[model samples]
Target: MKERVRAVLVTADDTMLVIRRTKPCIPEYWVLPGGGVEPGDESREAALHREIHEEIAGKAHIIRLLHTMESEDERQLFYLARIATWSFEDRTGPEFSAEGRGEYMLEEIPLTVEALDGINLKPDEIAHVLRGTMEAGALGDGAAA
Candidate 1:
């Protein structure tokens, strides 16, 4: 099975950092920052750190695992994290330059159900979970702990 990691990045302003993806033939959607775990990665957390750096040129302090999704062929782990800074223009992820991969824009959105309703965020399951948690004041501390 393949493994992937994603970050639920929260900023000091009480917003979530996400990637807005726009492809030619598909509807635009938002997603968290992350990618597959490479063989060279020392651990899942290490892989998340590397992905965050590559995708947004950001440094993050991962708080804890928030949610996990599993299927026959893959397991996706979502982590709650806080980011101090990032430069979207300096992103070095190869996917950004790949042909037909579409536009990846960094966006900071309020962590609210209304915000979630306005955009189509991938991995619907995770989005739903996050929204519910936010409404319940569970994300006040930035993680699921």
Candidate 2:
């Protein structure tokens, strides 16, 4: 089985950081920043931090484990986190140089339900969870702090 970690990264101004992926012959979609958990990673949170740095050249303070999804061969852990800054231009992820991996554009969108609805965020279950949480105000103003 494979394990992955991702961050629902919130910025100071209440926006969420996502990566817009564009592939040949496929519609563009957005995804949270993250990747597979490597054996060298000390923990899941550490893997998230490492992945954020690799994918966006950013550092994040993870607040909590927001959600988890599992399939027969893979499990993905999503963390709620706060990020103060990132430099997409400085990203060093190997995927960027890989062939046929598609385009990865860093974008920040409003952390509102309407904003979530407008994008084809991958892993529909996580999108639905975000909508429900945002509606209940469970994330709150300080969620990004």
Candidate 3:
């Protein structure tokens, strides 16, 4: 089965960093920063680090594993993390150069139910889990740190 790692990146100001995707003939949607766990990766955490660097040109301090989702063909691990900096212009992910690929723009949004409601975040299951965690006081105001 394939494995993927995603980062729920939270800034010091309590905003979450997400990638806004815009494709031709489709409504725009947002997703967390991450990608498949490649063979070169030493571990899941290592894969997360690599993906973050490639997609956003940033380094993060991973706090902990926040959630997991599994299916017959794939498993996804989501980690809660804190990032202090990033340069979207410096991104080097291969997807950025793929032909016919959509735009992947970096956006910072408040980690709130209202924000979640206003955006179409992929893997809605994870979004629901994140919202629940936030409402339960497990992931805001440095609570996860």
Candidate 4:
């Protein structure tokens, strides 16, 4: 099975950082900053840290594991985290240089439900989870899950 890690990266201004993907013949969508867990990674959290750095050129303090999605051949872990800084222009993820992988634009959107609804956030499940959590006042509390 394959494992992936992603972060619900929240900023000091109560906005979430996501990547906007644009490709030919496909509708635009947003995604959390993350990637597949590598075999060399010491742990899932370590992979998350590395991915956050590679994808956004940022360091994140992970608060806690927020959600998990599993299928027959893949599993994804989502963590809630706080990021104080990032340099999108400095991102070094290999995917950016790969041909035909599409364009990736780093974007910060409000953490509000309205913002989440306005874009097609992939994996549908994560967006739904966030919406429910936000509605119940269980998220965006700052530095803690």
lDDT of 4 by residue, 1-145 (tens): 9999999999988889999999999999999999999999999999999999998889999999999999999999999999999999998999999999999999999989999999999999999999999888777884453
User: Number of backbone collisions per candidate, in order?
Assistant: 0, 0, 0, 0
Local accuracy of candidate 3 as per-residue lDDT tens digits, 30-137:
999999999889999999999999999999999889899999999999999999999999999999999999899999999888887788988998989988987876
Give the higher-lDDT candidate: 2 or 4: 4
Q: lDDT scores for all predictions? A: 0.91, 0.92, 0.92, 0.93
Clashes of 4: 0
Clashing residue pairs in candidate 3 are none
Best by lDDT: 4
CA shift at 98, candidate 3, in angstroms? 0.2
TM-score of 4: 0.97
Indicate whether candidate 1 or candidate 3 has the larger lDDT. 3
* Span of ten consecutive residues with least summed lDDT in model 2: 136-145
**3 versus 4: better TM-score goes to:** 4
RMSD of each: 1.5, 1.0, 1.2, 1.1
